[model samples]
Target: MPGSITGTIVDPTGATVAGARVRISHRDQSAEQEALSGDDGQYSLPNVTPGPFQLTITLVGFTTQASSGILRSGENYTVPQIAMPLATAVTEVRVVPSRVEVAEDQIKAQEKQRVLGVVPNFYVSYDHHAVPLAPKQKFELAWKTTVDPVSFGVTGAIAGIQQAQNDFSGYGQGAQGYGKRFGASYANFLASTYIGGAILPSLLKQDPRYFYKGAGSKRSRVLYAIANSVICKGDNGHWQANYSSILGSLAAGGISNLYYPAKNRDGAELTFENTLIGISESAAVNLLQEFFIRKLTRNIPNYEPVSP
Candidate 1:
């Protein structure tokens, strides 16, 4: 005898789920019966053989469901309403800043850095893995250092001391002499800063900032600081000889000869001596930065220390 099977499909929220696929199969029968739930979420299979039957319901974006029951002879069997749960889905998203943008942010932090909350300490990066700066950013840093009020104050102090000692006697002592010394001192600062920290670094694709290595043995750190005077990290992040700083010192020293009193200028010999002195000064400053300056620097970002 043939019977019929009918059913309704719904979602977990108890709303009717139309267009769901409903299928019925009998163990004794080789053929399977299938129907799609209509707009009313109802499905029917008529003239099905009387036997134990299995019902399966499936819909897109929902889990498949199944039920089984026996059908009597010539009986119209109504299946209990089926509720399908939504399929689980996992999605991952990641947001990363561009290299230029990251470098800009780091520069902002560096600009805020000052030793003892007074002097600019903008050339040191606490973040060891910092992104390389673009040429514009290098120039910007140099300009900032040049125009800083503290820089002017420091230069004026040097001029005052030079006048007291009459070191450049060719200028003579007086307000006029003090003015000449101040202008000459500031010119040296400007020339060296732009030539070494900005122009040369940009041209050579080198990073001008010192990267602080906060993790290591004291001996290793000391060696690292001293080595930095002759070597630096390239834009590609590899260590290389620091031609920019070395050449910049020589260039600035050569330029000074143009303004310095003839007797004070020693030509190539003086330039080489100044360059060597500059290298020694850099090594000493690096040592101070590695061991003491960081403790006194204000507004430093709390970046993670590099691994040893």
Candidate 2:
């Protein structure tokens, strides 16, 4: 059972083709052949030893073409040009977005984590590339902290402590005295935070948050925490002189003179002294944040794991 077999291949448009795989087979025995079509879509398997056979042609990105035929000894079988159909499309698409939009959404979610369910903890950003907040966002955070119920509770507690200690004696011992002290303390809180955390930070391009640098050696982390009292991250993410914290400290101290008992008022020298004290206090608090507060904070999200 031997004969010759031949075939050609074409595209759906029925034009001459090349670079196609042509295969032939019979039961239990087979001969494989391949040829590129001439420009006229002509091909042949001349003198091909044959029996009943199958032919398949294929090309990239096109449906394969196939046919069946029979051949007897010394016969030439020519298959019509096999036309291939187009393959289905494989579509791929991708999407990307601006970084600022992602950061803004993060900020919105962080605005909700209040300590004791009341004190605003809006300043921290877990994201390393947290876009520098706009001036509006700074003030908005300040406003949120000021209006929180815990702020009033803390103010009342401070006023009570001052009354018990009789610290502002000029405010006298009574409801009116307590009122004066409360107002003064509340005013102090407002001025310091708005000036340091919002207004001046916006003007000076300083970030007021204690950036948690939870990595590196303990000594380096300690130094970074302390240095932050006098240095701050700028919108550009570089360390810069912390004019906002310094000036806000001084401004808060200066404003205190206006509301305290006249005898308790600090002169300019005392104001500068108090400002230094405030800076020291900030360093201590930053160190605490670096080491302790994260443990105490109940609802903060995205906290990095601290090694034991």
Candidate 3:
């Protein structure tokens, strides 16, 4: 004959735990009986096969409980009240920014950088492992550079100097001449900046920033800086020939022939000459960036120096 089992469930605080599942099983028998604790925390398993049996109680948010006892045939067995403890709490957190987000933050930092708090120095990155900019970011940087108030002031100053020296004499003299010179100079600046820094970089998947190599011997640093003009880091983070800058210079120079005086336009000869001049200027500026510019640049991030 089968037996019966009864039990009550509670929490660690001795409060009755309703809805707790109670399972009774005998090792010697294939049958198992189950019940759920009522509102009063009481449970009863009827028709349980009598033998060595185990009772298990389980509920959400509480630890499972088990009890074992011996039962005789046709006997009514009552299990001791089960007290369940609260389950331990576990939580996990992750705070990683996406690559585009990281790059945007870095760009924000770079935009604040200026030489002596005056001239823009947005093209230099102190972090060697800086994230590559997306196409939109490249254009954003170029736009920021070209539209800055300082850029206009600098271009106007250059035009004034050219006028004083009677350079680009085709523009003639007076306010009209100065206006034309100013327009031409600003156009050149805009063309070179966008073509070299944004457009070609976006298409070619290259980095337009100068990566500062602050460590190593003076000669090695000089070589690194000079070599950077002809070669640059690709978006893949590998060193590659700087076709973007080289071709951009040529393209910008070619475009200049349209606005400059007819006599000054040397066609392909002028384009190649301007390209060479641009490269030379880049090399010189890179040398300055390596040796002296960082000290003068304000709002620089406290980035760790990268090894050559």
Candidate 4:
């Protein structure tokens, strides 16, 4: 059934905000409608089909506000007066994050990302033009990733596989062997994540998160997925060599020699070869992120395109 939505727009200070863009969308349907607030800051979205709906309000210099609710059949739903928050700072070209605050918010949203509502996939960004993380935030993401229960479970599973296959025979067999393999596996994950995903990325001023390519042709996206393994976006928003990932892979592989069996420890040649393999695996994973993971991730924000 058809219904109507009406609301008044106000700034954080309670002043009426006129000329703000209001976008109303149906949650279960691919339908959207737009309206502009009037001089009195009042707007009406009449003849809206009843269902779950979301309303987004946008104005220059204000943080976007999103409101959602169920609209009953033939009912007029009057939402509370929408008061949009002011952006921390704004320039002629675009809005910049307020110091670390914006990045913190973005990070919080990213942290909630999980594949199929369980597996942690926090390193991918659904927003292509996301803000850069501050140094502290980078470490925070690494710590969070390392401490997640799922991460521990995965490491344990890898240890079980290795024990069953006797892949790392140096660790031997049985419960003690499983413990050794588990520790080694977790150490690898910790080192690589901190090095490639946090430490190096911080020092090099590069973003470690895989930016989702939701637009463009399939060929272009495939190229992007492959290229990201060797190239990354800097904090300045420019593309550059991905030394973080490359060097981190080498460093992690080299460090493993200290713990792995003598036979498994590769010389310099094998280290480089393993690094290359790691990069290849990263490309494959990024391709999955670009093409499939998002559909499985829960709690993803309805990210809109921002000016690059």
Candidate 5:
């Protein structure tokens, strides 16, 4: 049955507010009928189908108001008076930020993720469905990793160990030798991280982050971890060959020839060998990420459990 709804708009001071737009929406059908208050602040919506309905009232220079009620067949229902307060002077600073900003926010969250509150574990995405990072964001993450204070500390420690073991005798001993070895170690780190994690991934449109797999059988999880070394999610959200990781290792190994001692410089065979080793290292890291890292890592987002 069809019915009618009537209402009046008023201000807090009880003065009638005319020209207020009113919308009566049927709750079930998601249909709406609209009218405007007359000079006397009266509004009437006729031929409205019987149903539970909501009324939204709006006017210039006044806060919006809402009223709700029910209408019966052939009924002329009068809604309670709708009040329109003085419109809020809201300076809506709507800054529609870019995708890069959104990606940066996620990166900032990942940067805070540390294992045992110490080591940065920023490359693993607990969010399996995380947005693909932009190319610049990929570089930023690699740069952030390379320049972290912890990275320097770790590299220095490695240099100290190499010095103790009398490795890389070409650099000789003393403070100068330590300095040289440190430079070499840091160079290797920079090459590997930017090449593999940033440059190649950006170029190939592949995500450099390892997606964690926390909800699967042990054997399947292990297999997933190992397979991740050679397969990765592309920016298009499809799993594909991880050309970025595989080739980046080879590229980094090739670049090592420019700085490392002649004996340390990897030739063609050695470069391939290093690439294989890098892949193995990646599998091991992914295994740790899947089983152990998240447990130790702080600030991991609450992610829905996913099967491999």
Candidate 6:
């Protein structure tokens, strides 16, 4: 025989837990019952015959509970107070970071590194796909390099070397000749850099900076960088003829005739020839940049292969 069982459920705060499911069961040949707690957390299994029985309670996001006890026939069973512990909470967090953006930031930092800490060396890209600089950025680079204190120092040194070598004897000797040589050399640097690196690059939609290909077989990378002297990335991001560099060399050479001694003047044919010499000189410099400059450069970020 069996009797009735009843009970209430509550949280630690003593709030009534409504809608909690309760189960009453007996062993083999047993019966079962279910009910939701009322506002008072009270529930009952009505008209149950007395016998050994099991009680269970369950809720979502909470642990399940059960107990067993005996009930005598025609008796009423009052269950002990039921308390459920709060379920443990699980939290998750995710983070995504930008590698390309970080690389660009590093390049900006390296742009400040200068030869002997004064000459601007802003044109080398330490990362692939280094963002294309705006026209203003191109002009800014040329301006800074042209006006650098070290630029003036190097110009003076070169004039001294030429004076010693008597390379441009046409300019004569003594202080006047040295002044003329210095002015001519500096002017040549200014005209060529501004025209090639800023003015013509802006007008012709070309990028004046060198894109370093630091990978591939030695021969391939060498060829790629050398070819860049003649073929450049345009502002459109495509490789095209380097007309900016070519025309800039010619313009600088032609302008030089104005300052060189009259006896050393290159007629139209000689001006064009000197322009070709400038292009070849650029090719040699580009080769050094690809093969050697990175080793001497101090502030470049350590090279890391990009992930696929």
Give the per-residue lDDT digits (tens) of candidate 5, residues 92-144.
33344454675688788999999998899999887665668999999999999
Cα lDDT of all candidates, in order? Answer: 0.87, 0.74, 0.87, 0.86, 0.84, 0.74
Residues 1-308 of candidate 1 have per-residue lDDT tens digits of 57899988988889888999988875434479899998888999999876557787878898878888767657799999999889777432334355677789989999999999999999999877676898999999999999999999999999999999998899988999999899999999999999999999999999999999877789999999999999998887778999999999998888988998877776798689879999999999999999999999999998755632
lDDT of 2 by residue, 1-308 (tens): 34566767778787767777776654324457666666666667766654446676767877766677656446778886688777777542324333345446666767776656556667655443344676777787788878878889999999999999998798998999999999999999999989999999888877776667776688987998899899988876668999998999889889888889898888999888888988899889888777776566656667442211
* Tens-digit per-residue lDDT, 1-308, candidate 3: 57788988989899998999998765434667789999999999888765457787888988777888756557788888889888777432335456688789999999999999999999999977577899999999999999999999999999999999989899998999999999999999989999999999999999999999888799999999999999999887779999989999988888888999987665797689878988899999999999999999999998756563
Greater-lDDT candidate between 1 and 2: 1
Please give each candidate's TM-score.
0.69, 0.65, 0.70, 0.69, 0.69, 0.62
What's the lDDT of the predicted structure labeled candidate 2? 0.74
User: How many residue pairs clash in each candidate at the backbone level?
Assistant: 0, 0, 0, 0, 0, 5
Worst-scoring 10-residue span by lDDT in model 2:
91-100
Residue ranges of candidate 5 with Cα displaced over 4 Å:
1-98
Residue pairs in clash, model 4: none
lDDT of 2 at 54: 67
TM-score of 3: 0.70
Q: How do the residues 228-290 of candidate 4 rate in per-residue lDDT, one tens digit apiece?
A: 989998987678999999999999998998999887777999999989998899899989988
TM-score of 2: 0.65
RMSD after CA superposition, every candidate: 21.6, 21.9, 21.1, 10.4, 12.3, 24.4
lDDT of 2 at 260: 92
Worst 10 residues of 3 by lDDT: 90-99
